[model samples]
Structure formats: structure tokens, C-alpha cells
Target chain A: MEEQVLIAGFGGQGVLSLGKILCFAGMKKDYNVSWLPSYGPEVRGGTANCQVIVSDQEIASPMFEASTAMLIFNEPSLHKFEEWARPGSAILLNASLIASPLTRQDVRAYYVPASELAEQAGSLQCLNIVMLGAYVAACHTVDEETVQAVLTETFGAKGEAVLQMNLRALDLGKTYIQTQK
Target chain B: MAKILMKGAEAIAEAAIEAGCQAYFGYPITPQNEVPEYFAKRMPKLGRTFLQAESELASINMVYGAASAGVRVMTSSSSPGIALMQEGISYLAASRLPCVIANFMRGGPGLGGIQPSQADYFQATRGGGNGDYYLVVYAPATLQEMCDLTKEAFDVAEQYRLPVMILADGTLGQMMEPVELGNYVPRTKADMTWAATGFQGGKPRSIINSLYIQPEELEERCLAMFDTYREIQAHEIRVEEFHVEGAQLIVGAYGTMARIVKSVIMQLDQAGGPKVGLVRPITLWPFPQEAFAKAAAQESVQAVLSVEMSMGQMVEDIRLAVNGRKPVSFFGRTGGMIPTAKEVREQILALCNGGKE
Candidate 1:
């Protein structure tokens, strides 16, 4: 299977890190993965994005014009990438920040209240983790156990409170999508 | 060891360390800053030298100094920064110093944007520096190839006592992939009888200088270097070929552009379009002329296309290599604009249909 995923948000919103986590988890599952970030002149409030490809076959090019799936966190991202979404693609957006409805009828859209869920789980920093959970649930791109393993290994050094908060955020996102379906 | 995810720049730095790079000196530039940043954190911990030079000039000169002392040294920069170091690079070449230089190129004739580009092809393949010299240049397309070639670059430099270059772009530098780094066995330095270490009682003092007072002496040095260059050209040309045995069109590209062209070839194949092939040059300086010549000699091959991120720099080499065996065409995007797969596919189809794109 081949999954070309694009993640876009503000520079400080962990857009790049979210892509990195997915690639790392994909690697653990023996999938060929690549991550290419938009390293433009982006500041804290500026736009940021990354392209990720996880496939069973070797990836030829990391940059793609169309995405099989997209995780958009802001209105700017939604406006920018809506056209690049391929038909039958999945778009997971942040409902807390993007109030505009998706205009494309060819793709599937999942609206996750990532910011609200992060705050409810105790920190706004884990909003990316919430989106990750929703993406995993909606697309089945990776397994939940592999993601949890990655999170535990990545955040285990930060202390139990931070680790627990992100874990709770992941569950909240997953449950939200599952209940909606 | 198992594979781990690493950015291309960081992976190159680690590969250098694994290949026993003893010193690093470089100034920061966009699209390649991670190279120096990686060295800054890891070099000191490993009891090696990592200095952020005041400028690109100082960085290359420092490299010359360390290489003269028989230490494996490296430095990295982007397009404009590399231009600033041309003089020092020439000096290093003339002195026969073994060192590695990496150019994670960006758009430029001057200080251009910090995006991926192959505009520096002439600057890299032809001597960007002054004097009659050549650097063994490798253009790697993937992160895994980047690491493998980086490790091999140091060995090639030391083997020939000539400078070597890793010519990659910002996209390859910034991208991440799973790569299996080789075991970290520090390389043992070979016996360098000409290194400028402390003089022995009976031996002559080793002098490292590029200048020669007499014209005859300079000519002799140039002739000797050319002999080494001829040996390298004979034995070191590398290329990758795909479905070139009996194809109508053969696409030629290197580095990032190669990856894109390969994808387009696959897409065309899946769609049952014209039969296409690719010849990706791994060694840019050696040019892989033989590979192109042989591929073009096939009776089924009609035309050749050179794809690049610049406005047809490498196409000149392709034409010279083909030597009228097939009509060579060019397709490119410039100023940090990467060509998409659709664009490349269209170009290929146009070429196959006997039309200019």
C-alpha cells in the first residue's frame, strides 16, 4: 500500500513533528517512509507544511503534486491544499481552528476538534497528537499499538505527566472519530 | 544495526564522522545549516574538532590546513557560500589535499532563494575555482545513497589525494528517510609520506604550497595532476540504468531530478505508454559518458531527454556524450521550482511523439 500524506499548519503548531512521528512509526512497521518539510521563510505565526510518504515499495520521490491524505490544522492550510487532494482522498482537519467547510465533494473530510481536545487533555501542545489519533482512526495508515510505542519512546523522557497528557489526547481524538462514525 | 529515520544533511554529517572525518569547519547557510549543526553537537562529544568559521573563505582555508596535516576534514555550504570558497578550493586542489566538500545547492547566480535547485551544475562539474583542476563529484539522489556516497567520498579523496564534492540540493538535504548507517569503526590513516608533520633528522621538510616560481615546474605539476585525473576518469565513472536495453526514449538526470524522472517512467509504464528508460549519473564530474553513449546506441532508442531543475546545464554534457547518435532535448524548471511528475510525463510523451516541449 502507498499513502502520500501532507500535513500543514502554523510554524509553531508541530506540523513537521507530526509528520516525523508518522514516518518513524511507519519505519517501525517495516514500511518505506520519507518526510519532506516546506523549509521556507516561515516564522512562528507563518505557514508550515510537510509531505510524508509511507509505502511498501521504495519511494521514488518525496515531493508529490497531489496527496492521498492531508492533515490540515488551520483555515489557511485548508484553503491552500483543498485543490491538491486527490479524488477519494481523506482530509483530516482541525475543527477548533478551521470553521470553513470543505468545498470538495470528491474526497472524505474528518473534522477533529484538536485544540479543544488538547486543552481538555491538559495541554495545547498535544494538539498534533490528537490529530495523529484521528488520522490513524480514519485512515488506518498505521497501527495504534505502534503509535503508542513511538509516543512512549519519544515522550518517556519528559516525565509521566506529559506522557499521560498526550496519551489521553490520543484517546480523546480516537473516541471522538469512532463515536461520530 | 537497524535502520533509523534521519534527515539527509544530518545523515551526511554522521556518515562523515563514521568515515573518520577528524575536523570540520564551515559557515552556516540556508538549506545546509543542519550539516554544521550536527557537527557542532557531535564532533565535540567525540573529541573531534568542529569550528564555525567567520566566513566560507576561512572555513575552506581551515580545511586546507587540516588536510595538509593528513587529517580527514570536511566542510558544507549552499550555492552562494560555495561560490565564496572557490579560490580556497582551487588552492587545495593545487596542493593535492584530500578533503571532502558538500554543496547542498539552492537557486543562484548570486544570493538566491533557500530552496532546492540544480543551478550549480556548471559551478560544480567544471572547476568553480581557478587554475586547471577537477574535484571528484558525486550527485546522490536518495538519503541512503547520500550516506553511502559520503562515506565513499572521503576514501576517494584520500585515495587520489584530490578534493571530492557531494553535489546535492536543498530538497535532498531537508528530506528524511530510513537509512542503515554503517558500523562506526574509526578509519586508520594511511602512511602519507608528503604530509607536513614534524621533520625527521634525515628526511626533507614537507612543504604545502600551491605557488611555483618557475613556469616549467608549474607545468610539471599540472601534467602530474592530469595523469591522476585520467586514472580517476578511467576507473571511477558510475551510473544507474533502468530498462535501457530496448527503449524509444532514454531520460538522463541526476540527484533530485533523477528521482522525479524515475517516477515518471514508472507512471508511463503503468499506463502502457511509450517504452522509456533512464540513465542516472552517480558521478557528475566523470559525467558517465560511456553509459549514455551505449544507451543511445540501441537501435530502438529514438531520442534522449535531459531533465533538470535548472535551464539545461547538464544537457550540454548529454549532447557531447550522445555525439549526434540521438537528438538530445531538454526539460527543466528554475529558481527553486521543482518539476512535478505530471510535467515530466508530458515532456517525455512530447519527446516520444517527435515534438519539442
Candidate 2:
């Protein structure tokens, strides 16, 4: 289906990690995937972004302007991606920071307070996991179970403290969207 | 064969692993640092020597040390670092030591930027190191080809007793893709009969250096080396074509830029795909002349579009290949900005109809 996802935000906000997580998960699900990141003078404490392509066939080009989905973590991200999104694409926004309302009615828009939910769930860096959760829920490209397994494989060996908080983050994120959030 | 997703740098390292290379030497540089880092982790496990030298010069010298010992060895770097190693490469060439080097080139003239570029074309093909020498150059677009050709590079280096290189750009070094590692071909130090490991049996100490005071003898050596290069040009040319049959425009690009141009081909296809064609040169040196020249003369092809990262490095080669029967046009984006297929197709359409897309 030629699916493309772009995750963008401030450098410290974990946008690159989110893109990597999504790409890694999609790859494990038997899809052709590529993850490209922008890091340098342009992203020096400023805006950092990554483009992830997950396709059912060989991805022809890694660079695509109008992607099918975007997980925006901050204000700059929304400004960057909002213009380029296609007609029926999905825009997932982190409402805690992006105070503006999504004015476009052509695409499906969801505002999830990712940072607030992560903080409420007792971890700050879990914002990326929460966004991943909302993305999985919105896209359904990879099952939640496979994501948890791959997440462990990618991040589990670090330590018990990280393992514990990330697990909680994942669980809270999945449940929040499925129920109240 | 085991299929694993790897970055171009990592894939080159894995390819070295499968080839059973004796030692890998390198210093960290952007775009190609991952190759050395990857080798550091894996070489120890395989019992091969991996040295992170103090500088590119030291790394190339270390390659000299290992190659003189007649065990497969290699060093990798980007343009600036490769420039630092030029003297070492010249020494290796003069002494006739066989090894492979990887040049994952970034933008340059000085410390330009960390963007992919083909600016190193003249340096690579023209033997930037010294007098009358050519390192059989291999350029890879796909991660699989990087791995596959690394093995071939080692073989060719040893078989002809000269250096080999896999010339890539920042995109080829940093980008990740699926790659299949080929069957392991184990190499051991015992395989080299003429290696200088402190002369067992005391059969006259072998000296390896590039110094030749005798002018006539030096001329003979130069002729001998050229003979080897001629054989390489005759037998080692490799290239690929895309939708080239019966097309009005021919686009020539290499490495990562070629991959991007393919997308432009598909985009053109979607817009009723341009009656345009592409020639992707897998080898920048031993320049693939036959295929390009044969295609140029066909009445089907009206003009040749030379698309490259730099202003006009490959364009010169295209002009040389066509021999000026048809006008070869250039469309390039430099300092690491990749050209989109749409952008290139627009150029092709412009020349095709006497107007721009």
C-alpha cells in the first residue's frame, strides 16, 4: 500500500527514537522498511525529524513528500507536516504542547496529550512509547504484542529500571487510547 | 546466506567478515565510521585483526604492514581521511601490495560537509595517490551489492596484486537496507607463500618499498602494472540498465543517486513513464564504455542525460563514451542534496520536446 510515516519534533523530544521503533516494528512484521534521520546544524537543539517507509513491496525511494501518516511531537512538527499530508492521511498530535487546533478536515486528526499521559503514568521519556501506542492503534500495521516483544529486544538489555518503566508506559498508552483517552 | 538489515557501512564490514579478511584498519570519519566500529565488534570474535589507528595515515600504514605480510587487509575512510592516506596508497601501489580500501565519500574540496557526493571521481579513477597506478574501483548502490562486491574486491586485489576500492557516498554509507551475506570463505595466513613474516628457511630477506633508482627498471615496472590494469579494464567492467530499450533520453548515474533516479523513473511511469532510460554504472573506474557507447548510437536514444551528485564528473565520462555523436546534457545537485526523479524526468522532457518540464 506504499505507506510512509514521518515523526518530527524538537531534538530532545525523542522523535528519532519513535521513528526507529516504528520502522523496526514494521520490519519484523514482514514489510520492506527504511528509516532516515536528519541530525546536524539544522537540528541543533532545534527541530529533529525522521522519515520511515514501510511498504508491502520493495520501497522504490526513501524520500516521499506527502506521507500517509505523521506523528507530530511539537509545534514545529505540526507546521512542517500539516502542509504536506495527503487528502485521507492521519495526523496524530501531542496536545500538551501543540496549542493549535488541526484545521484540516480532509485528513483524520487525533490530539493525544502524550507527555501528560507519560508523566501521569510516572515516566517522562515514555512519551515516545505513548506516541508509538497511538500510532499502532491508529495504523494497525503491527500488533501490540509484537511491538512489546521487539521493544524488549531493542531496549530490554539496558537495565531493570528502564525495562520496568517502559513496560508500564506501553501498557498505559495502549489502554488509554482503547478506553478513556 | 543469512539476510540481515544493515547500514551500508555495517554491510561493508559484514562483507569483510565473510571474505575472511586477515585484518581491518580504519580511523573514524563521518559516513564511514560505522564500518570500523562494526569491525571492532565482530573482528575479535572471528579472530581477525581490527585496528582503530591514531589517524588515517597510521591506518593506511597499518594496511601496508599487513599487506606486506601478504595476508588480506583493508582500510576505509571518507575523502578528507582518504586524502590523508594518499601517500600510503601510493606506497602500497609502488610496492605492489594487494588490499582493499573503502572510500565512502562526502562533499569536499576541504572539510566541506557531511553530505554524499561523487566529487572524488577524478581522484579515484586518476590515481590520486601517485604515478601510474589504478585501484580496481567498485561502486555499490544496494547493501547486498556492498557485501557481495567486498568479497570480490578482496579476490581481485590478491589475484592481480594491487589495491581495490569500494567508492561510495554518504547515502551509501549511512542508509540502511536489507542485505544477504554470502557463504563464508575462510582465509588463513598460511595461504600466502611469499609473505614476509621474518623469513622462515632464511631464503634471502624480501624488501618491500617503492624506491627505484634505476630508471629503465622503473619503466619496466610501470609497463607491468599497466598490463594488469589493462586486463582489469578488459574483464572487470560491470553496469546495470533500467527501462533502456527504445527510449528517447538516456540518464546516467551511479551509487545512491542511481537509486533516487529509479524512483523518478517510476514517477514518470505513473505519469505515463517517460520514454526515458537509465544507465547505472556499478564501476566508476575501468569505466563501462561498451554498453554506454552501444546505447548512445541507437537512433532510439536522442540525447544522453548525465545525472550526478557533483556538477559534472560522470558527465565527462558520458561524453567520452558517446564520442560526441549526440549531445550529452547534464542535470546535477551537489553538496549532498539528492535529485528527485521528478526533477530529473523534468530535465529529460525539457530536452526531448525543446522545452523544460
Per-residue error at A162 for model 1, in Å? 0.9
lDDT of 2 by residue, B59-87 (tens): 99999999998888989999999999999
lDDT by residue (tens digit), candidate 1, B1-357: 899899999999999999989999999999989999999999999999999999999999999999998899999999999999999999999999999999999987789899999999999889999989999999999988999888888888988899999999999899999888986443355568788877677677889999998999999999999999999999899999987889999999999999998888887888899999999999999889999999999999999999999999999999999999899999999999999999999999988988855
- State each candidate's clash count: 0, 4
How far residue A85's Cα lies from its native spot in candidate 2, in Å, is: 2.4
In terms of lDDT, the poorest run of 10 residues in model 2 chain A is A36-45
Give the TM-score of each candidate: 0.98, 0.92
What is the lDDT for B233 in model 1? 97
Give the runs in model 2 whose Cα sits over 4 Å from its true position: A41-46, A102-105, A156-168, A171-181, B182-191, B202-205
Per residue, candidate 2 scores C-alpha lDDT tens digits across A1-181 of 7778888888878887777677777777878887777734655469988888888977766777687988899997798779878889988888888999887889988788889888876678888888888877777777898888878987789887786677677776667667744
lDDT of each: 0.93, 0.83
Q: What is the C-alpha RMSD of each candidate to the true structure, in Å?
A: 1.4, 2.7
TM-score for predicted model 1 compared with the true structure:
0.98
